[model samples]
Structure formats: structure tokens, C-alpha cells
Target chain A: MEGCTIIEFILLVIAYFIGLILLGIYAHKRTKKTAQDYFLANRTFGPVILFFTLAATNFSAFTFLGFAGKAYDSGFGQYGIMAFGTAIMAVMFYVIGRKVWKLGKEKGYITPPELIGDRFNSTSLRLLFMGVMVVFTIPYLATQAIGAGMLIESVTGASIGWQIGAIFTMFVIMIYVIFGGMRGSGWTDVIQGVLMISALTLAVVFIAINLGGFEAANTMAYNASPELFTRPGGGDFFMPMMWFSFMLLWIFADPMFPQIFSRFYTAKDEKSLKQSMILYPIVVSFLFLCPVLIGIWAHGVGLDVSGQKDMVLPMMVANYAPGFVYAFVMVGALAALMSTADSQLLSLSTMLSHDLPFKKRKISEINIGRMLIVILSLFAILFVITSYNPREGIMGTLVKTTFSGLAVLCPTTIAALYWKRATKYGCIASILIGETSVFIFQYNILPTFGLLSAIWAIIIAIIVLIVVSYLTKAK
Target chain B: GLWWRQSEPLMFGLPFWVVYLLILTLITSVAFYLFSKYYW
Candidate 1:
């Protein structure tokens, strides 16, 4: 916002990049031998690092940036819906995570789709899900990269080219993820997790001090716009949208997110998996509250900068915070964005290379994974450039809607894991319906409903799976 | 009509704030031992 602030931000950006480059080099040398070392961190990470890894997979830039914007503009209801989807998923981790962990250990599984395909006897199902995941996630990835660049701008100044910043940071993420693998990602997540909290805590503290405290923040916000705190559906419709989006897209629909699944086979026992599950949702709940609170603070302060929404947190830090504190905020935002991006690039790459049918032995998987990393990187960069204006982009909208559509897979996936009777046809039917729903919704051909898309999709999927499984006798 | 702070606490006591720090310390110590014995 000022000349001196811009100078401080640029210096902070330099220091943060230097730190990450060194960390990448350090990880590359530390773990190099087996793919297990690369992908699963040798299955030896303690509950702590493992805790953050599971949590990191959830705290994307969207949480830090987009949701903060949402919180700033709307109110707390959206945050509550996020909690609901997360709580249900956490229970899955406690109940289903252990099962997946056990099965992974027994079978030497690498991805969620591997388990899904094996259990249900459906190869096409695995590939189809993986394809949707990669395509849908690229926009999600672009969101991360763009958010990171925006963070750079918020701290340093708008003079820094977003495309330039995004590409450079993305390349750094690829190097660490490609070379060091999950260990790199997991360790980085631990550091990034700390930075994310520190940045959030710093911002929250500064804002609260300025506004006096949470009570004062609430009072001031009410003074500005009573609707900010109390409105139907929590003053904004975004929360219900997220509940459907997160559950269907993340929980039930996309069964195999490679990062989380990669950890499943690596976790030592059922106890570790259960503990990690319980710990993760709670940690995420805490991390999410920081931004949401900051959003409330922003409303109270009455700062109405327009067009760029996600930049609220960083810009607020720049405005209210001292120069050195602003530096910390800059690095913290970097931690949040890259933590999510590194895993995304790695997982997307792995899905393409190892999961897709390459023309050779399964052991030949290593090389394909790296090559796919480069392609995914290129594809993501192109998509970001095309997006030009993220708010109007078809990609993000498609991803948001499609996630709800995937709700069709929820019942089928959960049933497949436990119910031995879950036939291949059941899984197939769910996938077909889910994919079709996403396409239909993306085109806006259907009317809006009260329930989330994922909920409706899952409801339909379960009914079909039950009826179809019943009609088709077991072999 | 409804109370809000109830959702944000731990064991309804002072421990909620310190829980993650404790877990982090415990997990790190155990991990260090496991890694040194097996992978390192």
C-alpha cells in the first residue's frame, strides 16, 4: 500500500524463496532410494508430521484466501458448514481410515483408486475417477498458484507479475515433490502448518488489538451492517454450497486423493490412523477459524477495497501490521499456498503416470510419474493464464459444481469397502450417474435445489447401488 | 437465543489451547526415534 511497504514485501519474498530452495535441496539429498522413501516418507513419519500432512491436504489457499474473502463479505454460517463436511470426513478417517490403512498394508496399495478398483473389480472405474480428479483439481491448483501470487502482490506490490511469481513458485514445488516425494511434502507441511498458524495468529492478534477484541469486532461489524452477522443461511449461500462441494468432491466422490491415500499404506497401525483422523479435523477447525475471524474483523474495520477479494488477509497485514510483522505474514501466506500446491502437483502427476496404463512393468512407474509432473505443471500454467479473471472462469465453476455431482459415489464407495456384496456394476452405475450429473449441472440445464448436489448425487447413487447390487447376483 | 463460545473449547478447560503443542512435541520425539532406528 506504500513505497516502504512494497520494499519490505520484496525483501520478504526473496528470503522466503531462498528458504524454500534450500529446503528442497536438503530433502532431495536426505531421501532418494526407494519410491516408498519418496512417496510415503518411508512410512516412518511420527503422528505429528503425519497429523499435519493429513491436515495440509485440507488447508488449500482457498481456505486462506477465498474463504477469508467469503468471511469478510458474508458471515460465520459458511464456516459452520465447512465444519459439518469436515466432521463427517473425520469420522470416516477414524472408522474408514483404519480399514484403508489395514488393506493398504496387506495389499501394498499406493492410491485410493487402487483399493477402489481392486475391491470392486473395476479398472475403468479407477481410471475414470482419476481423470476427473486431475481435471477438476487443475483449476483448484490454479487457484492455489494465483492465491500465492496475489499474496506476493499484497505484501510486496502489484508491480510483481503474477504469472512470473506463480510459475517460479510452482517450479520450486515440483522440484521438492518430484525429488523428495511425500517425505518432502510431509516435512514441508509441518513447517508450512506452523507458518500458516503463525501468519493467521499474527494477523488475528493485530486486527483484534486494533479493534480491541472479538466482542468489539462483533459490535463494530453490527454497527456497519447487521446483515453481516445475522442473515438467512448465515447471510450468504456459500456454506451450503461448500458442504455439498467438500463432501461430494472430496469425501465421497473422489475416493482417491493420492497424497492422503499414499499415507494410508504407510501409517503404522489402526491406532495411528484413528488418532490422525481425530487430530486433523480439530486442527483444521482451528486453522479455519483464524481466517473466518479475520473476515469478521475486516467487516468491523470497514475496509472496502473492491474487485480482488482473496487479498484481504495479506493486504490487511500490510495496512495494520509493522514492516517486520508484514514480512512474517508474507512468508506465512507462502507457507499456506505452497503447502497445498506441492502435494497437488505430486498427486496429479502420480495419477497420470503410475495409475494410467503405461506400456510396461508396474515397476517402470517411477519415470512416468516424473514425466507426468512436467505435463501437469504445463497444463496448470496454461489454465491459469486462460482464467485471466478467476471469478468468471468456467474451470472453477465447473470444479465447484462437479464436486457436488460426485456425491453419487459416496454410498457406493463406503458400501464397497464394507459390504462384500457391493458388485462392480454398483460402482460403475454410481460413477456414470455422478459424471452425468456434473456435466448436466455445469451446463446449468437443471434447476437449483435446497440440498447440496453431492447430497442428491449420493442419495441417487446409494439407491441405485442397493437396487442394482440386489438385482445382480454375486459371482 | 443461543450460546456460541461453547463450540470453540477443549475438555471445557484450559487444555484446549495447549493440546496441539503437546501433541506436536510428543509425535516429534517418537518419530525421531523411529526414523533413526529404521530408515536412517
Candidate 2:
């Protein structure tokens, strides 16, 4: 039976890859051989495709593994933070996303840096924006690879080790991304996004039934660890200040993520972007509840995932779920991570190829972008094998590092779009000060007053940007 | 905020705070829907 289950899992994984590759080939055929078509899918995504791609890209391994892990370690507040915070971010989707889409369509902007650089008319500012994006996004990207490796390792019982699993996942993602570009990534996101939501919903329902019911599961978990149901949760992680900090952080930071920022340029119309904004909160809020519930319920089932909280969901499925169900959920987890990684790779490639000051060469821009995808994927794989520390937990690392770092860019981006007097020097000073402050707060160089470092960094960045812009305004 | 620190008063198999947040999420969705239809 074990052998049979292993075979079934392997076959499912292979079939999933084949489907993705076929989709990539189809997208390649449809592709117009232009930089615009390759990077932004010719600016033709409708509401449904836009919504799925945006949600899938935004959620990532962080949603699948990290949410559950944090819920296990913290508590129910995890749901409030993500669901509510993301719902609020949808407002920005209209405020920032609409303007970005219009500007991108009008100005022929292909990357986030392009929009910023053109607005400021400064190559230095553009490169700095690109530099901050690439530096921060790589760690987040590495987390996806790490999540994929761990999922593979858990499902196969280490028959194929994490290193191989990580490399293999990156390799497959590279092929599809290079082949399909934006269209391929968008189309696959629709499929993977649906699969991830459905599989997780089913797995959670199945697990709840097995452990009695939703009520019983909650009761058992609460009885085992009552603190989990409250604010400040198990280790006092979500105190009032931190809760407020997170709520504010996601609003400013989420849309700043390079993959998500690049996605704004893909919307076919303002209506499509608006439709996505409406659906985002509803879908993401509900979907997030599934993993958080499962993570908390793992405690109900008496699974002790003390140090390795990220493994809670996988470990629970492995122990209680049928082999087929286990395989399906693992595939869903892979879908979650791969969807995000492919977009990240594509967005990074687009930014580098379009925004950088490359000498005129015979190679087409699309080809150069494709080569960067390969290089970036390999770099991510190397980071996963060499630097990723599993015990720190995905949510903790992201909130401390990626979320905070990218968030500092929000002030600069918003200023570029809305503030006409926003000089390049102002933008440059904001990013420099914002990132440096985040680093300081992260390493405990200064107290956060019980709030996340991001809040402080953003405040500092905003003040610096405003003050600097006023001082350097053109007469 | 301090009132939600206790684990009692489970509403529909979830803590009251969890239920409150879920309700808040539903409200947010409805609000966004209205925003999309009318305001946006």
C-alpha cells in the first residue's frame, strides 16, 4: 500500500508538470514576440484572470505554509491580520492599481522601475527602486522554494531530499515561465489558484470530520492551549501594538510587492481592476480561514510542532489523511508556491531587462529577460540550499524581512504617483532612509515601541520623502 | 482589545474574537462590492 501510494503521488506530480508545460507551450504559440506581449501579456487580462493571478501571486507559500504555522504558534488572530489587512489593501488596488494601470498603458511602462524612473526622470532613482525590489524579493522568493522543498520532502518521506526537490521545482518553474512569459504565468495561475483553494478547503473539511467536527476541533485545541484563541496569543506575539502595526503594514506593503505591482500593468481595463478589487477581499478572506483553522486544529489533534511550526499542516495531513488526499494537498501546496515563484521570476526579469541601462545589443529584450529568469531561478535555488533556516518559520522571517523591506517603498511609490513635487532626490532619500531604518529595527538597534519595525520605517520614510521633496522642489 | 483576551463565549465553534473578525471580513467584502458597483 505504501509503495502504491508513492507511485500515485509521483504520477500525479509528473502529470501536473506536464499540464503546466503544455499550457506554457500554448501560451508561447499565442505570444506576439514583443517585449510588451512577453512581459505584460499585451495588457489584455480580464477581471477573472486578473483576480486569480493577483491573488495567487500575492498569497504564495506564505499563505499555505506560513499562515498555518503562525496560527499553530500564535492563534486565531492570524486570520484577522491577513483577512482584514488584505481586504483593506484592496482599497489601494483601486487607488494605486488604477492609476498604475492607466499610466502603464499610457506611457508604455513595462516594469515598476520604469514607471518610477520615468516619473522622477532619474536613472539613479530607478536603479535604487529596482535595487531595493530585487534585494527584498529574493528572500521572499527563496521562501517559496524552501516551502516547495519541504512539501516534497514530507510527501516522499525523504526518498527525494529537499535539495533535489527544491532544484526540481525551480527547474520546472523556469521552463514554464521562460516559455509562457506573462500569459503562461497568468493562465497557470488561474488553474493553480483554483486547485490550491479547493484542495485546501477539502483537506480542512476532511481533517475536521476526522477529528470530530469544527466545534470539537476548536474545543480540543482551545482546551489544549487556550491562549491561542486570544490576543497576544501563545508567546504574546500579537499584542495590541503589534496587531495595529500589522494592520497598517499590509495596507502599505502588499501592493508594493514587485510581482503584484507589475500585475497592475496587465489589466485590460479599469473595470477589470475594480472587479478584481471587489472579489479579492471576499475570496482571500475565506481561503485564509482554511489554513489558519487547520493549523490551530493540529493542536486539537495533539500534533507537537513546537519548533517547526511550518510543518504543522503537512505533518497533520500525512498522519491523518488518506494517501490520495495527502497527495492532493501536497500538490496544492506546490501550486501555491510555484504560482508565486513563477510570477516573481517573471517580474524580476522584466524589471532587470527593461529598467537597467544595458548597452544596445543584437539580442532581443525578451531573450535577455528569459536569460535573467534562468539566472534568478538558479540564484533562488542556491539561497534555498545554502541559507534558508526552517526553524525560524516562514511567517516570522517574512514579516521581519521581506514585508518590512518592501513596505518602505510604499511612500516613494505613492509619492511618485500622487505627489507632483516628488523630486528624484526625495525618492532616493526615502528609500535609503526607509531601508536602513528597517535594518536597524530588525536587528534591535532601536526599540519598536511594541510595534513591528515596518510601521516605524514607513513613518520615517514618509517624513523624509515629504521634507526632501519640499527642499529639492524645482523652482 | 483587552476584552478579547479570554477564550470563552465560543460562537459557532469559534472564539468570539474570531467570529468578530470573520464578520468584519464579510462586511469588508460587502463594502468593497458596493464600492465597485457604485463608487469605483
Candidate 3:
């Protein structure tokens, strides 16, 4: 909280940005002029880069800020829901990702829509997939900007507003992604992923020691809010049905994320993808515990994060850790969001350029993709600055909008991959009907039967896909 | 749900369910490793 410490934090952040720009320049030099090279890094990612990029891309503001905030509001059940659910998702990385990788490498597919469209031989389905991904991903991208804005506002003690922080975060991400493309983002992800894990581990250690170590901290938290230690935690948020719903949701939704989906194509071989899958659960199991523990400990230590639970991690760090630790942790937090936003912008841009039926021109697709990154980033920044409300909290916003909407695509995707009988009509109906149901359920227009809207949406989409596929198969 | 709802018998300062979940994650990781080595 010292002015000097704030100065140190600003300096460190500037230096970090410089390092990223340098990496971007290096990647730009390595990048070939082809669309595949820019968008998919020429399918040359080794195991290590693939693992880190996948990890860093997936663990966004959602993991760093949103997880802690949800833990603060709900309880430790957050850990069980996230860790176990995501671990289970690693199975899909093989079941789904392996196939996607094989197909992409075989067919030279660049984007998720291209793969799906080629399989079904339907341009309409491809456009629908692209449309859904773009619509859903933008909100998730906004969450990263929102997290950056909140972190800056909290770390600077309001000398800097959230709008400035959000814009600055988007601007830096755009520069690197435009320069380096996937290779740039992938390499930066390696550094950012390391920083993110190291900072969280260090922050947790410092906070635990400050609270008289892990046992004492846990005891204090339990005494302060015993409900957090149980399922259907603090606010009765994680009921049995809801818990089941969440676990199921991650399996379907996570693989469908355009950023994550496109990553399947970037791996050098099946071995790299397999290694990433195996490492994912082990890494997630440890990394997630840090923020959840910090959130619970903040409550135990009585940090008064009521209504603004998303700030719990930052508030705790600023109050408990030394200025150096605080500064490093904030940088790590920035790394988390930036790593994700860059990937999201790049993936979305790739889809827009490659999948959409734009008129042919002299401009190469890679250049068009670069221009789209800036445009998409501007839209995300606008969303954060004008539309985002910190009070709604990141977790709730993501679950309601992005997570549920994307999750609905799972059935269609699965059928597309696994079921030979799946027709274009079935895929189209599944997506349209499923997404509509998600919208309806999210708005409470229909009942969710004590489950998340995503669960119902997935179910409906699967049935529609099967029935429609059968009915249309004779044609 | 009933078992996890109980808060007694903390392990390493974590609630019983939290430890249980961590153990489950480890088991899942082991499963993934096995799959990666032998099956994948």
C-alpha cells in the first residue's frame, strides 16, 4: 500500500509488457506468411509450449479473480466444483481433442468451424458455429478486461479508474497478438503461466504464514464461517443438483471454447496433446487451491468483502503481504488475464477471417485476422468500460452468459465428432434449439429443475440432435 | 452429499471434504497418467 510500492508495481508491469513485446517481435520473425502459420503457429507447438499455452489460455480472469470471488461468496465448495469438474474435462481432451487434432492435421483445418463444416459439408452450420462462438466468447473476453480493471482500481487505491486499466490491458494484449499471432501468444503464455502459478503459490504461503500458518488459518476461517466448509455452501449456492449440473457443464463447455478448441490444431503431435491432458488435472488441482484458500482465509480474517467478493484476493494480498509480494502477485494476476485475452482475441479473429464468407481480395487472410483482433479488442474494451458492472461479479456473469451458452454447443460438437449419423439439419437444430433454451433458462423464462440452465440446454440439444438426425438421415 | 456436509476430522487444516476432493483430484490425475502412458 506504500506509494513506493505502487511505483515498483508500475515499473514491474512496464518491464513485463516490454518483455512480452520483445517475445512478440521474436515470434513475428519466426512466423511464416501463411494463414496457417499465423493462426495455428504452423502446427509446431511442442509438449511444453502446448501445455503452458493451453493452461494459461484456459485459466483466465475466471480462475484468478472469479474463482476467489466465488469462493468468498459461496464457500470452499468452489474448489470441489472447479477442480473435480475440470479434471474430468481432461478426458474430453483426449476423447474430443485427439480426434480434432487428427482431423485438423489431416484436412489442414484452421478453425473449429472449418472442422465442423467440413465434416457435415454444411456452410450454414459452419456459420452458425462461428456466430455462436463469437457471441459467447466476447463476453468471456470482457471478463478478463473487467478483472484487469478491478485489479488496477484496487491495487492503485482508486488513483486509476477501472476504465483506464481495462483499456490499457486490451491495448497491450492487442499489440502482442497482432505481432506474434499464435506463436507469440503461445510463447508469452509459457512465461505468464509460470508467473501465475508462482505468484499464487507465493501469495498463499505469505498469507498463510501471516495468519499463523495453514492450520491456524483454516481453523480461523472455519470459526468465522463454518458453512463454507460444507456443500450447499455459505449461501446454499452448491446444492446437490447444482453441483451435479456444474460438473457436467464443464465437461461439455470447456472443450467447446474457441480458444481451447483451436489449440487442438496447434499441437505438434498427439503426444503433445496427450501430455497436456495428463498434466492438466495435476496442475489445476494445485493451482486452484491457492485462490480458494486465500478467499476463505480472507473471510476468516474478516476482510469485509461483502457484496464485492471479487476483490477478496487483492484486498487480502494488499492487507497481509509485503509490498513486493503484493506487486508481484498483481503482475501475476495481469498475466493471467492478458494470457487469456490475447488467445481469445487471436482465436476469434482467426475464425472471423477464415470461416466467414468474406469477398476475396488481395489482402492475405493473416492480415485480415490481425485487423479483426484490433476490432474485437475494441469491442471488448467498450463492453468493459461501458457495460460491465463489478457488482454482478465475474463468476455469475460468466456462468450465466458465456459458460451456459457455449456449453449448449457441446452436444452438437460431440455428435459431429462421434456420431456418423449426425446430419447438418440435426447439428443446426441442436445449436439453435439448445442456445434458445439456454437463453430462456438463463432469463428464468422456464424452470431449470434446481439445476443450472446449461444442464437442461445440453440435454435438449442432444435429444434434438438425435431425433433430427434420424428423421433427416433418409434424405 | 451427506458425507461431505460434515465438517469434523479436518486433514492438514482443510475440511474433510476439501481433503477428500483433493484426493479425488489426485486419483483423477493418476488415471489420466495411466491413460496417457498405456492407452493414449
Question: What DockQ does each prediction reach against the true complex?
Answer: 0.05, 0.70, 0.74
lDDT of 3 by residue, A164-204 (tens): 98889899899999999999999999999999999999999
Question: Which sections of candidate 3 miss by over 4 Å?
Answer: A2-4
RMSD of 2: 1.6
Ranking by DockQ: 3, 2, 1
Q: What is the C-alpha RMSD of each candidate to the true structure, in Å?
A: 6.4, 1.6, 1.5
Ranking by lDDT: 3, 2, 1
lDDT-superior candidate, 2 or 3:
3
User: Candidate 1 lDDT (Cα, whole model)?
Assistant: 0.64
lDDT of 1 by residue, A13-103 (tens): 6776667666766777887666556656666766787777777766677667766777676665445545444544554564456677778
User: lDDT of each prediction vs. the true structure?
Assistant: 0.64, 0.89, 0.89
Give stretches of model 2 more than 4 Å off: A1-4
Provide a comma-separated list of chain B TM-scores, one per candidate.
0.53, 0.73, 0.72
What are the TM-scores, per candidate, against the unseen true structure? 0.84, 0.97, 0.98
lDDT of 2 by residue, A213-284 (tens): 879988998888888988889799889998999888989998999999999999999988988888887887
Candidate 1 regions off by >4 Å?
A1-7, A231-256, A361-363, A392-399, A405-407, A441-444, B1-40
